[model samples]
Each structure stands twice: as structure tokens, then as C-alpha cells.
Target: MYKNGLKRIIDFICSLCALIILSPVLIILIVFGTIFMGGNPFFTQPRPGKNEKIFNLVKFRTMDNRKNKNGELLPDEVRLNQYGRFLRNTSLDELPELINILKGDMAVIGPRPQLVRDMVFMTDEQRKRHTVRPGLSGLAQVNGRNVITWEDKLKWDLKYIENITFLGDVSLILQTIGKVFKRADINREGTASDIDFGVYLLGKGEVSREEYNRKQAEAKELLKRR
Candidate 1:
């Protein structure tokens, strides 16, 4: 109980301090993004927070609105400009989420908020991640991040939920700092976007019948390797 209390206090104080130090940087990003992206500097999307509650999570816009020859929006690669890629590599794009923390919509550390569509694949056990407010950094993120499989990320989330403590949160924060400095696991090679849970599931045949048999075979092989 004391640890939980301390964690919240740490979240409050740390987030407040960060907001002060990052304010100038945030302002510059907004102006630059507006000029380059031709819209608001920030991107807002509904994400699943604690208890599966939805909240408008914010991030600095790291891609432009560019479409393909068919008039459909282009792939993430096509939309990702050079400046956007740099911002992502430096993790400056996530700065706007500090506002979410200040608004009581998130914490500085916990399971990173996931998309609503991703929630559909979560089992009851996996849903335990929602017991605490989603955060900007989490165990999975500090670990392998984009390199880890969804199943591994789920395990780390559960571990974090069970072992949450002030010290643990601090440790995760420190680890996140190292990751940012090293630009580790920021994106998959040959891709400008992080792997989407929905797309991964569809590709793996988890949501479709035609590919179900093939995916099931692959899953069995994966299990055997494990």
C-alpha cells in the first residue's frame, strides 16, 4: 500500500517536472509539425486505458497525410517524412503524452496504452493490464519493445502489474532513458511504423478462416520451439 502511494506521488512529481523542462521543445515541435504536416502538431487517437476505458491519447505528429495513386492513403512508409523519422528515433514524438499524464488520463509508468482494436484479442488474463492506468513506458517497452512478440509483451505486462512498486517504476524509467539514447527497438527494419497488433493478428490468421490452418501450423511450431 505504501509503495502504491509512493508510485503515484512519484508519477505526479516526475511528470510535472518533465512538463516544465520539455515545454520549450514541445512548442518548437508544434510549429515545425504544423508547417511540414499541414495540420495540428499533435495526433489524438482513442486508446484503451485502465479498465478498458477509452481516452484520447496524444502524440506529436510523426507522419504526413499522403495518399497513393488510387487516392487511398499511402502506406506508413510513404507518409513518413525524413524529419518525422528523426523525431520518432529520438522519441520526441511521444512528448505530448505528458499532457495525458497531467490530465489524470495516464501515469508516467505502467503498461503502454494499446489500441481499442487490440483489446478484442486480449484474453481475460491478459486484460489484467487494464487494472492500472496505461503509461508512457512499461516493462515490455524497457525490455525488447518492438522486437518482442505480442505474447511476450503480454507476459511482461502481467509481471509489471503484479510487481508494481516505486522502485520498479524508477527502474523502468531509467531503462527507458537508456533505450531512447541508444535509439533501441524504435522500429522494425525496413519499416517506419511499429508493428500493429491488428495487422499482426490478421497476418497470422488469428482473425480469418482462410489462413487459419496455416497459422495454426505455424503457432504449433512456435510452441514446439518454446
Candidate 2:
């Protein structure tokens, strides 16, 4: 029923309507983001979508492109400016993902797409979140978002895919609205973004530092082709 096909229909209709209704906000974000974010107003990255497919997930760029002495991009905290913080806190930065939903790269609700690096670290069981389209807002997001442990996040994602229903999606959507209004769990502890899954695994002794480095390198190489 809903999971098989109806959900995609609703996601498309809702996102199309949302794009129309939110056009003004999107335009303003683009104008201001371009001005304050140095150049590019949008942040795009290769995210793992359904069945581990890669897609360019789009959002407003919240961090400036700053590099250290070695020309490596600075850490997220340093690059995250006040404007970026505002966008993050309000979740206005995510508005551009309507385009993703519109294009069928995502859904209005489902398991959120994670970084390619994160995807590589996922077990085969956990990666099953991709059985459905990625989401703009997801079960894991409303539960605890970036503050939740990766283990719990993956658990919720797996739970969502087991049985999706119209009522369930609506409930999650409503819960997501409330979470956004409260600006709850937007970031983990004091950081500007969630800790990388690969980093988390390294800390938990699940993966050796060498393995982490190697897999991260692989993810970077994959991004180059995207």
C-alpha cells in the first residue's frame, strides 16, 4: 500500500506544494547565503540514497570555505559562522531539499540520507534503511537527531523501514515539525555537526584508525567522480 507506491505519490504532491509555498523563503536564503557564505550558497554532497545509490543531497551552505595552512578545509566549528548557526538552528538550511524530494531522490519522510563515509561504515543490516527513499525529516531526526548515538540512530532507521504506514508518516512529520520549532538536537554537544560515523566507530574501537583512514580515503575518491 503506502510503502509500495502511495508514499511516493504523497511525497511528490506535498513537496511540490511546499516548494511553491516556500519559494520566497528559498529565494531569500539563496540571496543571503551567497552573500554571507563567501560564494556558493548551497551545500551539496554525495549521500547514499535508496539501495546505497549515490545522489547529490542539496542544502544551503552553512559553513564558509576556509582552509588551514596545509590547504585542508578547516573543521566544521571554525567554518560555521553566525549566519550558518542561525540557519542550522532554525533548520532553514534544509529547505532546498524540496528539490531532492521533487526529483524523487528523497521523500518527505523516511530514513535520512547519511554521508558516503557514514554509509561505508554501516553494517549490511543497518544499510537496509536505504530500502526506501531518503527523507528530508526522518524518524531518527525527531527522536534525537545529531545528539543521539549512531547506534540508536541506526536502530530507529531500521525500525522505520520495517513497516511504514500513512498514519506513521504523518505522525513522524508532525513530530519533526515540533522538533524543528524547538530547535532540539540540531547539533551534537558543542560541535556544529554530528560526529562522523567513521569517527564514532574509531572511538568505539570498532574500527582501527588505519582502517578509518583508508575507508575515508575511499569515500573521498568516490566523491571526486561525483
Candidate 3:
């Protein structure tokens, strides 16, 4: 009952309330991000939602648009300024996603959305993560976030889909709160930060460099249309 209906009601109410309560913080971030990032305050992009449907995912812009001499964007680590790092570390950048939940494009608990381009690389089983609305926090996020491997993250996402319940969602929400407060598993080892899924797959030889580059270009083009 909750999975099919009541959960969405709860999500709508909670997200609405959160947006109201957090309006000040949101306003502050909007102003700060606009000043620091020198552009839009929000980062909006097309991400796959339930059943691979596409929607524009919104979040606070945490990185500056720094480009190199050739006009290519700088590396994430380079573009991510100190304030951006703080927003990421504290999960404050995610606050704007409450609007997504309110709009029915997301849930408070479910599988986190991945890049639309990344969808092409997912195995059939992994694609099951999109069976439900994408979430602000999910099983993979609570368990290991970006620190875990792609395989494990997909497994956790599928597990959540297979076993979603009102109590289960509540438990995951509480656990997510704990994880955020502790700021655990923010990054992987032997690196300055978490690696992108495409990079990870490339390292594992699952995707050729050419394919990854092509997919990246396609993603950029798609985002441009948005």
C-alpha cells in the first residue's frame, strides 16, 4: 500500500514541508552560489526517472564553470571550490531536490538517479533500478555512497526495489540522516574524490575509451538541449 500510493503522499507532504522550512537556507545558497559560481544558482540536468523516463534533476550548483585554454571544462577537483566542497560534504547541495520530490519526479527514499548516458552502459539487471522514482537518498547512498563499486551500488539499488516498504523507507531515511551527519564514505581511497561511473567502467575494461568518449559527447549534447 505504501509503496504504490501512501509513500508518494508522504513524500509530497514531507518535501513540501522541507521546502518551506529550508527556504532560508535555500535562499542563502542561491545567493552565495550565484556570487561564487558566477552563473545560475541551480544545476539542472536531464536524469532518468522511473522506467527510464527523463526529467530535469535540480540541485544547488556546487562547482564553478572553470574552463581551460582550449575551452574544455576543468577537472571536477579543480572546478570544485572550497565552498562547493563544503556543500558536497554536508549534503547541503542536495537540498533543492526537495522540489523534485514535490514535483513527483523523485521520492524521499528509492534508488538514486544516474546520468542519462550511463543508462546505455547498464546491464539489464542493473537497469531495474529505474523501476521506481529516483530518490534524494537511497540504499546505495546510505550504505557506501560513492565509495562503493558500481556493481555493489546497483545490487543495493535492486535490493531496495525488491523490498520497499513503509518501515523500510523509514529505516533508510533515518540511516541516511546518520550517514550525512557523520559525513562517512564521502570519497574512495587512493584518490582525491569519488570517481565517475563511466571512469570506473573504463578502468574495469567494460567500456572502450572511444565508447566512453562518445557517450560523454552524447550526454553533453543532451544536456545542451535541456
lDDT of 1 by residue, 77-132 (tens): 88888889889999999998988887877999889898665665667899899999
Q: Write the residue-wise lDDT of candidate 3 on 1-226 in tens digits.
A: 8889999999999999999998998999999999989979899978989988789899988789999999999988798898888988899989999999999999999999898777767789999899999999999998899888888989999999998899999999999999999998877866545667788899999889999999788777766675
CA lDDT, every model vs. true structure: 0.82, 0.91, 0.89
- 1 Cα displacement, candidate 3 (Å): 1.0
What is the TM-score (0 to 1) of candidate 2? 0.95
Considering only N, C-alpha and C atoms within 3 Å, which residue pairs clash in candidate 3? none
Q: How many backbone clashes does candidate 1 have?
A: 0
Candidate 2, residue 22: the lDDT equals: 91
Q: lDDT winner among the candidates?
A: 2
Candidate 1 Cα errors over 4 Å, as ranges? 2-4, 209-226
Cα lDDT tens digits, model 2, 101-196, are 999999999888999999878888998898899999888999999988999999999999888999999999999999989999988887768888
Model 3 / residue 205 / CA error / Å: 1.9
Score every model by TM-score: 0.87, 0.95, 0.91
